[model samples]
Target chain A: MNDFVYKWRNPIFGSVSVVLFFLGWEALLTWAIPLNPFIMSKPSLIFEGLWLEMQSGQLWSDLLISGQPFIFGFGAAIVVGIFVGTMMGWRARVGYALDPLLTALYASPLVAIAPLVIIFFGVGVSGKAILIFVLCVFPFVFNTYAGVKSVDRLLVNVVRSLGGNERDIYLKVIVPSVLPFIIAGARYAIGRALVGILVGEFFAATAGIGYRIAWFSDMFELSRMFGYILVMMVVAVLFTEGIRWAERAAFPWRVGM
Target chain B: MNDTTSTAVSPVPASAAPVRDEGLGEITRRTFWEANERHALGIGFIVFVLLLWEVIPHILTLSRGMDLFFTTPTQVAMTLYNMFASGEIWPAFKFSAVAFSVGLGLSIVAALPLGVIIGRSHTMNAMLDPFITAFNATPRLVFLPIILVWFGIGMWSVVVVVFIGAVFPLLINTYAGVRNADRLLINVVRSFGASEWQINKLVILPNSMPFIIAGLRLAIGRAILGIVVAEFFGGSSEGIGVMMNDAAGKFQVDIVFAGLVIFMALSLVMVGGVKVLEARLSRWRPENVKSF
Candidate 1:
């Protein structure tokens, strides 16, 4: 019983702190603001708004809209990133050749250029997806390329000495060595991709979580906007945790995991 | 990413001539070129992009009498030049730079101590794990409206947004640095009867400098991101974002592009400046680890 209590003490305390924070927030909203309750609704009111939005299917639709671009962009990042990164890793000359452009693209703030993308692609899913792609792909590719380059030279030389062909050298020597970097990169990319989606929705789109939050903000529906922000936070947390889970599953050999 | 191979290689050039049957001078030069050549693609891409930007609008105008969708590089340059000449860009730049500095400063102050404290305590780490996860993962832009409600749509609200956004990276990095400090070294310091403050100052600070600096780099980028988002939502009267908002409203594609170019350039310069500083620090740092 003592051990159980000790183990759970911090979690309990943390939870209580969080609960108290919300309670305090509610108290401030109510008593501190003697006049306009609707302007800054209480925590209870925010919860009720969340429940209302959920019941109306508005929250679900908003989630789906926000989620679509994230899914598309993330998928594109993994596929294209892996392909290009692997190629760049295996082919030194090619990697060297493309290095400068990738660096510029990697350094460029794609969010700032989000408007240009909207101009070219229109204010739709395409623009959002492109923004996400440009933002997320760089880290993935860079990590993968680094992983490939950092592969044990001794192992490669051994394979070569054993008369291993390029295909054998790549499959047996390079891919496994670089897998961890790829996974790590992908893990980082997930958060970036989400940011991209949010940024896109903020600027260009008429739908998605970003759009909903902005819409609520514009209307000055403080409580509902707060509710949507919470929802977005939940989504981001879940997405990040899912990525970490995937990384642990795929790269069990990773020391920390 | 260029290693200090030259300094290490120069002395060996004369001595290694007969040892490897090839002069070390040749190897060093090859390494230098190989390092430098990595930048070729970036140069080529810039040229290619410039060419496209220059050619595309002219072709569109000639073929369809429409350059609405496609703006020329010349037009973008002209817009930037006009903004520069008129000194219209200064206020926005000043606002952003000031906001960025303040938020970044606040984040460093709050995060560094908190992170160090968390790093020092396992109980605190386990306790705040989920909370920190949620806090860090939360898209701060979503809070812009609420923050505006609380702080009002001014520098304070924008600064709050930037603070929230930038704090996570510094905290994470500081925690990482402290956690990763060599156990043996800590023990050695402790054996000398060092106080907590002494250990932190002499041992922990030096060991974690790289990670702390790395976190600062990430924080700066996040700071820029948060500033832009805050400006977009929180009704900021000036800054690049206001220009962006104005340009977007009027469908001034060239002006919008110009704003974007300025922003990207600013970000690149800031990030690149930090990268250079990091490189210099790493070189001067006692540890001889290779950097990427």
Candidate 2:
């Protein structure tokens, strides 16, 4: 009992604090601002709203709509970004040539360019996917470039000294070396991809969680809006945790995880 | 990132310098700066890409002379020049600056103390960590719709959006900074019968400066993002975002490009400032270990 308590004390206390926080908010909403759910929503009403949306079948479809851009844009970004990043990593000139453009794209608030994105790509899933791709590709490229560029020359020399060819050098050394960097880049990209969806759907997306957020809020359906917010947060948390798990599984040698 | 790399590469053993033929990390930066200031291969590559973008239309012989979504660099430059000459961008720039300042100010005020309290208290840290991580992972733009509903359409909503977006980085960094306090130092201070406030002031706050500075750097980017996105969605009429919207609505791709350039420049300036401060504050920080 003592060992168990010691081991899980933080979690227990933390759960208590979180529960207290919710109870406090519930009390404030129930007694203080009962008249105006729009001002600040209560937990009960939010769950109720969530239930209504789920029952109406609009929730699942919107979730799928939101998932599509993530699948398309983030998927494409992962595949192509790793390739470009690897190429840039292998070739010094390629890294130099692309570095300036990548720097600009990375630093610039791509959110400001949403209007231009919509204009150029015509407010479709493809357009939104493009936005997600553009927003997400930078981090992968940077981490990958950094990872590949910074590889030790001594290792390559040692491999060459041994009867290893270029293919052997790449397969034996570079791939395993840059795996962590690729994962780091993807981890960074995931958050941006989520934001890219919101930015895309906010502008003119036809059907997505972000679209519902905009539509519901415009109609003063704060509970429904907050419901979607909660759902998206769950999705985001799950995605982040999932990546973390994969990173740990892939690189058991790393310490920071 | 470039500046960081140059300094970061210095801590390596000298033995590896001659084994390899060329180190791009060393040579690229040195030559990029030393040769004609403009004739470096890096600069040449950058210029070639931009010039290629400018000439692609002519090369392709596209119909309507590249008016259909492809913009030339020279055209973007000319349009930016005209906007500057006409003094139209200044007001939008001012609005964004005001919102950014006000919002960042609010976030700093809110996040610092709360973070300290949570950091020092084990219970608070345990409970708040999950919430903080969840909110941080969730994009700040998701809050824009709710902020708009609560505050209505105006600068106020934009400011709140900025505040929400920027606060978490500061809070999380401050928490980490405080929580990672040196145990030996804390015990030594306690043995001297130091008050909690004295210990915090003498040790915790001072030790946390690097993390706080790093957090500030992260927050600046998020705040800028929030302000721009908020203005776009919050129906504000006075921001650079509004100007981009107007330009984009009319298919003025050059103006949109101009706005983008300005925003990127602003972000670079902030990042540069933070990098300078970080260098100054991080003297005790050992050179980062290279991960392989």
Candidate 3:
């Protein structure tokens, strides 16, 4: 019994804790303090709402709509950010000129400008993509720049002594060194991009998970709103875990770092 | 070989030294320029961009239609000055400042003790880890709608949003710090007949100072974002975000820009303040150990 308990401790404890939490929530709502259903939803109600939405295929459509901006924005950010970051890292002049501007943008609440962005690009996929791009791009740029700055000087010298040219050094040394940083930046960008998507959709969007959430909340469909939030939570966890898994696969040695 | 390598790696061009026979005054000037080159270039670049921003609308005749969406830097500056000079910004600033401080303070109070407890106890950590992970992964904005419903749309809702945004980072970092505290030191304290409370007070809290400060730095940005976003969505009419939203609705682009500048400045000051605190508090730590 002790051996079995030890073997299954994590799973056993984890499940018990989750189950207990849900049960307690349900019990509190049902018996202890019966609040208005619309104000505070129970786990059962949320699940039921989720199931209904899933069956109606609204959830899938919302997911698809939201995924487009995220994919396009994140994809563009990676390409542009890496390119810009490489330029900045390679040339001290470029880095010096751009650092302050980038720092200001990174630190500021860029979401406040969502309305202006919508005005520029219209309330469409492009606008959302652009917003997400702006939100996600900075992390990549900063990380890649730092990674390049921290590249082993000795390695570069060794490459040069071996008659390697700039292109060879970049392709063989710089790219590999910076790949981990790029991955790490992508991890940061995932959360930022999600926030961007939500803010964009909240501000002005016809279709998307965020729009649905706003719609549900406006309509006082609290359970449905909770359902959508659950979906967002799941997506966030999946995306973050996926990136972490990729990072581990790519650079096993840099796990803790 | 050393000379060649040094010259090759040096940022200063060798030709600059040789092309002009420099006097003491010239050498001093050049050295000063070199020392502050990054700052000079950065400021110069900003000035160049601002000039372009001021000129482009006029040059392209975009001031007629596009000016509603995009304003020149001078216009933004003027609007910012007017907001302050006329005392229009003070109420909004006060509203946001109160919410931010209260929310962040509450988070610090709640998270610090809970984080220490969770970090110290295996059973508590095991039980609570999954819930913390889920909540942390979930964007705090998703809770805004429910919070608004529960708390009713006002300063309290905004405070709740800021609290949620700011709490997880601090909690997680504090937990990490406590876990990463020198086990050897704890054992040493134990051997000296120190209790767990004494050990935690003496060794663990001090060891975790850098991590906690880093967490606070991250939390400040999130908390600021929370303030803006919560005010934007919560229908609070008395914060910077509400002012910006109102301006946006009116197509007062300059006012929106001014508000954004204020937020940026606020973030910079808070983060900078925390960094100074971190530096002062962690003076005893080795350089390598203080990186976090």
Name the top lDDT candidate. Answer: 3
Q: What is the lDDT of residue B169 in candidate 3?
A: 95
TM-score of chain B of each: 0.85, 0.82, 0.88
Q: Write the per-residue lDDT of candidate 1 for residues A40-111, one digit (tens) a residue.
A: 767887899899999999999988887777778878988898888777766666676677677656765557
Q: Give a tens-digit lDDT track for model 1, residues B97-149.
A: 78888999999999999999999897788667677888888767667666776
- Model 3, B197: alpha-carbon shift in Å? 2.0
Off by over 4 Å in 2: A150-172, B1-39, B60-70, B283-292
* Model 3 per-residue lDDT at A119: 82
lDDT of 1: 0.78
What would the per-residue lDDT of candidate 2 be over residues B1-292, giving only the tens digit for each residue?
A: 1222321233467897786656756566675356443236667777888899999888787777237666888998998898889998788888988989999999999998998899898777888877888899899889887776777787788889889889999999998889877878988998999999989987888777778888998899899888778877755777888887777877778888888888888999998998887887676666661110
After TM-score superposition, the amount by which residue B96's alpha carbon in candidate 2 deviates from its true location, in angstroms, is: 0.4
Listed per model, the TM-scores of chain A against the true chain A are 0.86, 0.90, 0.92
Each candidate's clash count: 3, 0, 0
Fnat of candidate 3 is 0.52
Residue A109 Cα positional deviation in candidate 1, in Å, after optimal superposition:
2.2
DockQ of candidates 1 onward, in order? 0.40, 0.53, 0.51
Q: What are the Cα lDDT values of the candidates?
A: 0.78, 0.82, 0.88
**lDDT, candidate 1, residue A95?**
79
